[model samples]
Target: MTQATMTQTKVDNGVNVQALIGAREALEATPAAAQFKWRATCQWVNGTHSRSTVNSFFGLGEEQERPRSFTVDADHPEVFAAEDNAPTPAEIALTGLASCLMGGVASVAQHRGIQLYSVRATVEGDMDLQGILGIDDEVRNGFGTIRVTFNVDADASQEEIRALVAQAQKRSAVFDCMTNPTNVVVDVA
Candidate 1:
């Protein structure tokens, strides 16, 4: 096959593998270009309800803006003595984790030339409210455990699917952030 034909055949699972490879090569060539800064602003709407907006970020050595602004509302449930405005912060964290892992799975599958028919992820997090309520100092303010189960239909063996998920976990930034300690600074201006 010609070089062009070989390159054209690299597309899989709706991802252009050649482009992915090209991006990696470009980042490797300029290591500083790989640095990215994500930003989000949150505004309090009412009791335990707030909206966070994501419209721009710093990436690839320059400032970048999204094609459209996006906002997410977070609030406590009715049981927490607040309006059920939207998903809770913990739920949003779960969503981020699931999305990050799923994206990794798709990217890995595409690069590996695996044809994916469907992918579904179920994420569950167990947390105790005692810590947040100051009822139990021993309990953590975050999830005690988080579990992710993926149901993927692809043209690959069971072992390959497991390997794909394992690789996704290994490469997932959200997984690393949640599993490891990150320095966070909070101050009122």
Candidate 2:
């Protein structure tokens, strides 16, 4: 489904949130690990209340202010990685993976009429010095991909349970690396 379709729906009680996320998981998962990439727009302010916008959730709830914290890249549209104590880009990526796998499995379980009592995912990544410092060309940068260890509680044989999880991941838009491959269109906004 298109990204617009995903955002068109709103949640008054927040129950429809999962359906919303699942609907646009494909497109939403395309952008970097920004909190929200519905083309978030923020104006600069030297004083308090730095950025404000009508789009997305920014400039709305909480009456918050943009702290001095921010990161800018010469390429791609500028992103608000965090205000002050914002989670690092790497950290956000890990969270996305967890959400994708766990949510995907849950959705599938619903279809199979299986009661998943507990589901947990732990993810880890390694950043080589060269990748971190942007010094080594031979060594690929970023997460070099990631690994996930899923601990699940269910009533199925090991093979059956594993197959179900794998199937869910396949349908998951966020988990499909090749399907929702990220495109870094950078040029600073």
Candidate 3:
């Protein structure tokens, strides 16, 4: 891929400059109503497999319907008595983290007037399945640790890019959600 020209600051590097400006303006105009809520529904398909659909999300002022349907599948491996058709839930979670961070990087870079040629992130989580299988009470059911590595190519110094990533992480909702405790309620109908 070609390197981004430093002189061509007017070009948007995959991020929508106009949309970002508009969103910032809207938020500044109404800080109290800037909260956004996203929703998705999931249904069981079979053993260790499920599908989620995202159709609408509420934000800014009202509920907005999606222009197209978005679907995701979650499934375990065949070794776990699953069809191995789709990615496991843990894998999907990692994907979500990576995607969110990438978005943050792009948005932050754009806002800072930096032109980026490429940005990539690799995320890995260490998990012990013994807890989920009830084979070991000492083991945790989720990831014990998660690691992320970012490779960014931009017309900026390494220190500047590092600062950009740090700022992005601070602004990423997914990163906050993963690091902070969230209350979850489960009920059977």
Best by lDDT: 1
In order, candidate lDDTs are 0.90, 0.56, 0.86
Query: For model 2, what is the error of residue 103's alpha carbon versus the real structure, in angstroms, after optimal superposition?
Result: 0.8
- Best of the two (1, 2) by lDDT: 1
What lDDT tens digits, residue by residue, belong to model 3 across residues 1-189?
122345554647678868878988989999866888889999999888899999998887889898998999999999988799899999999999999988988888877777888898999999999999999999989999999999998887888789889988998888888899988778988
With candidate 2 superimposed using the best TM-score fit, by how many Å does residue 152's alpha carbon deviate from the native?
0.7
What is the Cα-based lDDT of residue 56 in candidate 3?
95
User: What's the TM-score of every candidate structure?
Assistant: 0.92, 0.55, 0.90
Give the winner by TM-score: 1 or 2.
1
Query: Candidate 2 on 1-189: residue-level lDDT in tens?
Result: 222234553212113445645655854665343234333345644322234343333322223345444432121112433334334556665776778778767766654445566778898877665855568777866666578888877644567568868987787756675247677676875
Residue-level lDDT for 79 in candidate 1: 96
**TM-score of model 2 vs. true structure:** 0.55
Residue range 1-189, candidate 1, lDDT tens digits: 222234565435777778879999999999999999999999999999999999999989999999999999999999989999999999999999999999999998887767788999999999999999999999989999999999998777888889989999999999999999999999999
lDDT score of model 3? Answer: 0.86
Q: Is candidate 1 or candidate 3 better by lDDT?
A: 1
